[model samples]
Target: MPPKPKKKCCSDKPACKRCPLQMMKKGTLPPGYTVKKRKLVKVKKSDKKSKVAA
Candidate 1:
């Protein structure tokens, strides 16, 4: 398995080591990992969604 990706990106022009964007480009991101708002987020295993109360 590959090294865990960085939780946050340095936002550098060249992308820092373990940067999520860089890992994505390199196709080394682990399962359930995704980049959101320039940060790496792990998808909830429960897949639960907030319910709006009527």
Candidate 2:
């Protein structure tokens, strides 16, 4: 457990501005992320025969 000291080379300067994947690859992706597109309602084989005849 003694082999961890080689992480400071994002062009070696200013500590790479505290890299978090280089600020999400320079896109700054971490502020209430959202991409919503939900609309799933598939269940209509005539309502499955009235829910199997109750």
Candidate 3:
């Protein structure tokens, strides 16, 4: 069995205090805080093509 995946801090607000990405960007992460890896989102070419057609 695979190990359990880590929980991601998925806040959309800018400079979210609880978000790991924001904490890492600000260099204010608390001691022993483990940063979770972020998943990459795939963009659909159809959406871009439709926008270009408009």
Candidate 4:
């Protein structure tokens, strides 16, 4: 079974097993969730916007 996710992050340099940051490195982070600056953040639709020359 996959390891359970942690409710909060300890922000350790070497993230723990249940750390979201570690989970992200292992590509196990759930959809809509991403790690930024070592913190787990919910993805926003606008954040996906890319600058495209029309």
Candidate 5:
């Protein structure tokens, strides 16, 4: 039998959230740095009928 494959990390940066290294450290950030909060922006949808009429 073959061994199970390891899961891949999804974070863009090294040791970022969702990374195995981050999980191993128990969610603590490196010294002299803080986590930045991301804000969500809502976009308004344009009407297709109005675009076709133009």
Candidate 6:
């Protein structure tokens, strides 16, 4: 049997660049395929004080 494709989980991952869902959201995906979606969100700052506790 042929080797299976290496799975990718991020848009920046070369394997996921042309994924169906990414294409669908951009209206470039073709009919009948589905994909898992993930949001690459920004990190939020903490509300704690700058000083550290002993």
Ranking by TM-score: 1, 4, 3, 6, 5, 2
Score every model by TM-score.
Answer: 0.66, 0.15, 0.40, 0.57, 0.24, 0.31
lDDT, candidate 4, 1-54, per-residue tens = 778667568877777888987898799888888877766788877756788999
lDDT on C-alpha atoms for all candidate structures: 0.85, 0.36, 0.49, 0.78, 0.39, 0.45
Question: Which tens-of-lDDT digit does each residue in 1-54 have in candidate 2?
Answer: 222222332445464444444543455534433222221122333434444654
Q: Report the error of model 2 at residue 20, Å.
A: 1.1
lDDT winner between 1 and 6, please give it.
Answer: 1
What local lDDT score does residue 36 receive in model 6, on the 0 to 100 scale?
Answer: 45
Candidate order, lDDT descending: 1, 4, 3, 6, 5, 2
Per-residue lDDT for 1-54 in model 6, tens only?
A: 322222233546554545544554666543333344443223456788799788
Instruction: Supply the TM-score for candidate 1.
Output: 0.66
Best model per lDDT: 1
- Model 6's TM-score against the true structure: 0.31
Better candidate number, 2 or 3, judged by TM-score? 3
Candidate no. 5 TM-score = 0.24
Estimate the lDDT of model 1. 0.85
Clashing pairs in 6: none
Cα RMSD, model 2? 16.3
What local lDDT score does residue 18 receive in model 1, on the 0 to 100 scale?
81
lDDT accuracy of residue 18 in candidate 6: 54
**Residue pairs with clashing backbones, model 2:** none
Question: Candidate 2 — what's its lDDT?
Answer: 0.36
Candidate 3 per-residue lDDT, tens place, 1-54, comes to: 322222466767663455666655666554445464553223334534344554
Residues 1-54 of candidate 5: C-alpha lDDT, one tens digit per residue: 322212444556554454444443464433333232231123345566554654
